[model samples]
Target: MKKKKGDKTMKNLKKKLMYSIAVSTLLLGTTIGVFASWSGQINVQPPGWGGSVVSWSGVTKTSNSSKFAISGIKESNSLDPYAQLVNSNAAAKSSWCAIRQGQTTSVNDNTGVANYIYYTRCKTNNLEPNSNIISYSFNPY
Candidate 1:
């Protein structure tokens, strides 16, 4: 018996459908595999709102130096480190307390742009015994 023309057409249609499904599956698998192993680097610019906290240390009457490190900071016009000796006394109503002896090698104290570690050394006069906090803050201008 000879095969009919309609039967051959039906067989060809089935083969085409199967081939299309296989190709689609292979393409999807390849796309997923390529995306699964993706590795990339991200660079963050300096933020506009917040400042960097370089250092924090407790202050005492004795001489001590507080060191803070700087990292990942790019060049900017107003990037500098600031050091302050704070007297956190609850009883003392006066906002202004006795000044203590201190020195800072901050970028603000320098002539040009500086990047790296910053230090602040303070020798307490011990006049305001309640004041015992040294704060170092970094701000962009």
Candidate 2:
């Protein structure tokens, strides 16, 4: 049987449509994978301080990548307080690094006493292959 000219055009159009759909699906999947992220908070306290001095530090996985970021905000009466990010694994203790030093500000409350608040900068670090867990330390130094 002889094929009409329109039949050849229709066949080429269908091929192009299928290719476009397949490419779109693959790209969509990869885009979603790259943008996925997770986040959590850990309560931390400065050494020698009691539970009343504890603060929640924010931590987040940087968009499904092997990296994470941390930030801390604490209310204290100390000078030069800061936050540090460290690998939770004991073997990786040497990997600890100071993330940020607090930007300090003093405010007077109803008691007329000076209250100091520490707002540390957010910092990011790469995840170690065997140390996915992260711990934070708030130091009132």
Candidate 3:
């Protein structure tokens, strides 16, 4: 017996649904870490509210293939980085802190940006407690 037009449409819809599911599953499964450099330190949060970490920036040097990295950050070089983040938001209370290349502590000093213009450079491991400054920045979301 010939299939009805409605039945054919339903069958087509079912096939499309199955294909979509299969493609999604395959894409997710095959994506077992095809992105290498993408595994770097990347974490962006809202400005926050009510003691929810208004805005905290982090910078660290990634060591090894996929493991612990040096937390070297200095305050002397916190000028541009801190200012960079603050400038992005005129009403941002930008606070800055850096961890040592291999240690976890504020190396140089703490920088603050009570008000900003529109320039925030979000780069990590760009400086060290006992080393020169490393410059890095990114686009503000």
Candidate 4:
């Protein structure tokens, strides 16, 4: 077959396009992986005078390796705060307690996959009426 004048140019252009696309895809994947994170807050108020309250927040992260920090404030000192990281099946993967005011409590799960996190506040030794407003923020990476 006789070689056409534009055939070589067209072949070169096609190769360049494919290479550009491959490089773009690799860069996009790396960017997303490096800057992926999720954060939220939860508030719980117990109805009774001496019971516990629990609230849950969910995330879309799919990695088995995860780290999270939870911090919160309580209206009363009698209420103790707790945080937990759970998997997609609602199983407890890791848990932390004694979340103090103005401080953060963190948990790192390298082997257990997590999809949800929850916070709890339990009233202890306080016979007074329950008028506690507990709020917690969850940050996961």
- Give per-residue lDDT, candidate 1, residue 45: 28
Please tell me which predicted candidate would have the highest lDDT against the true structure: 4
Query: 1-141 in candidate 1: lDDT tens per residue?
Result: 999999999999999999999999999987764443221211222223322221222222121223221122222223232233222321211121211123222232222112222222222232322223332222211
What's the lDDT for all of these models? 0.31, 0.34, 0.34, 0.57
C-alpha lDDT (0 to 100) for residue 54 of candidate 4: 48
- Ordering by TM-score: 4, 2, 1, 3
Residue pairs whose backbone atoms clash in candidate 1: 87-131
Deviation in Å, model 4, residue 127 alpha carbon? 11
Model 2: residues with Cα > 4 Å off, grouped in runs: 38-141
3 or 4, greater by lDDT: 4
> Cα lDDT for residue 72, model 4?
64
Give the Å shift of residue 103 in candidate 3: 15
Candidate 2 local lDDT, 13-122, one digit each (tens): 99999999999999998776444321234444334321112233322222222222333343232332323322222111112233332432221111111122222222
Q: List the residue pairs that clash in candidate 2.
A: none
Please estimate how well model 2 matches the true structure, expressed as its whole-model Cα lDDT.
0.34
Error of 1 at 72 (Å): 14
